[model samples]
Target: MKQHPLLLLVTLTCIPAWSLQADAVNGGIALIPLPDSSIAPEVWYHGQRVLVTGHDGHWQAAVGIPLSQSAGDDYLNITGSSNKIPFTISHRDYPEQHIFLNNTHQVNPSPDELSRIHGELKQELDDFAVFDGTVDPHALNLTKLPVKSNQVLSAFGLKRFFNGEPRAPHSGLDLKAAEGEPVTAPASGRVLMTRQLFFNGNTIMLDEGQGLISMYCHLSQISVHEGQLIQAGDLLGYVGHTGRATGPHLHWSVSLNGVRVDPRLLLTPALNASLLPH
Candidate 1:
């Protein structure tokens, strides 16, 4: 089936005259212009820190609208600023996907397994809450692809059903990586957390400056340790079918300000123009 790009309409009203840059689509980013390069204002959206970047004496904050966000008015708050930025969010429909699982245990875990899963989920949430404000804000640019393949086995934001039972939406991009294939960091960042889980398996979460973070999951091996600093294209791990996966592949996810956006959005032309230098 052909994949369609999800669309969202955002309207900004009663805000400062700072130019509204970047697309305002669902799973997309919106760049809110800042007062000056020196003013690193604290911006918040959906109770999470907004990723900020500065260039050429101008500063802008990037806010990622989640795919599940309904069409309506949304607001961003800048601490100590009197004016509130109001923007509209539009609707985007994702396609449904069905997968049959041979492992019935994964589909319906035992009581002990459920307890373990809950603990792992809490750890992941804590990791995602981290935001390192020390790194260069301009380092938010994702310079490389995590895996070597251009083929995508599955797109992001698809509603998935396992063995005729509906499950959570697909939250990340699935790349076509062979078993034991090397996975690398797409951007420079510090390792935040690494752990194996029932759903994600061996996972490495990297904090790429500000509120930009990336995760590589279902790995056969992890080469980096927690708190380790990694450069772009640095080896993170090897791909595998370690978790609930049916086959060997890489599940890569990108989070902005704690909101899970499409990983491919970072590769889009619109983001490259605004986030990357010419």
Candidate 2:
């Protein structure tokens, strides 16, 4: 087919952008260059931090990743820029492990009850995804954990299966803690969502502004509420196996620009330094 001159030019122009759609940066890692004020959030690899910088007329942000977050296909859909760009993320795979939830707790419901429980859990998670909040990402400084309890029981990005049926990849870190354990905010953020979920039990969602959000699940009780602005080390709630848990623990997750990334990546020195009081 004979292509028109304009069509050929347009096709050539899109080649580079199209190629980028399949590119993957590590989790928490992004090379954001906002030449214009219109670029939206981008997705980096699933387990690495990405660095982004604004140059010339562009603004950028980079993210470095830690050993959390499951690897898989991810995308960055940007908007409101002079140019709209969507980046593709290719996640590298890490080793996988499984723990037998084989021993059922006496509190476990019967099979019919479990089915009902699953439905309720889905509803709660959906609520977090559709939460309404002001899109802000810079009003607060990301901070370090106030205490030193950083042991990880379940790392992010591991593919999960329930009862031999493949399930969604795990999106958060599961830290072992005793019931009634204190949970604190790692940084300053606004409480955007707080609810009792079927699977999460007591839950909290914090908005760190600019489309960054954090989720804390399976709490025994929630201490914050929607629209409440909280500071670093602020009390969020107590740990428990509230939702669809096999035991008592805390499931912590982080989402950047709406993409679920490994929360541990944000704890690194580079990201942490950027969050300190200047």
Highest TM-score among the candidates is held by which one?
Answer: 1
Model 2 quality (TM-score): 0.64
Q: State the lDDT of candidate 1 residue by residue for 1-278, as single tens digits.
A: 64432311111121132232355667767776766524467888988888766544455678888877878888888888877888877777888989999999898899999999889978876777677888853334454578887677888888999999998888888988899999998878899888888999999999988878889999999999999999888999999988899999999888888877877767635433433211
Candidate 1 wrong stretches, greater than 4 Å: 1-22, 35-37, 137-140, 268-278
Reference-based lDDT, each prediction: 0.78, 0.58
Cα-based TM-score, every candidate? 0.85, 0.64
Give candidate 2's total backbone clashes.
46
Summing lDDT over every window of 10 consecutive residues in candidate 2, give the lowest-scoring window.
14-23
True-vs-predicted CA distance for residue 233, candidate 1, Å: 1.3
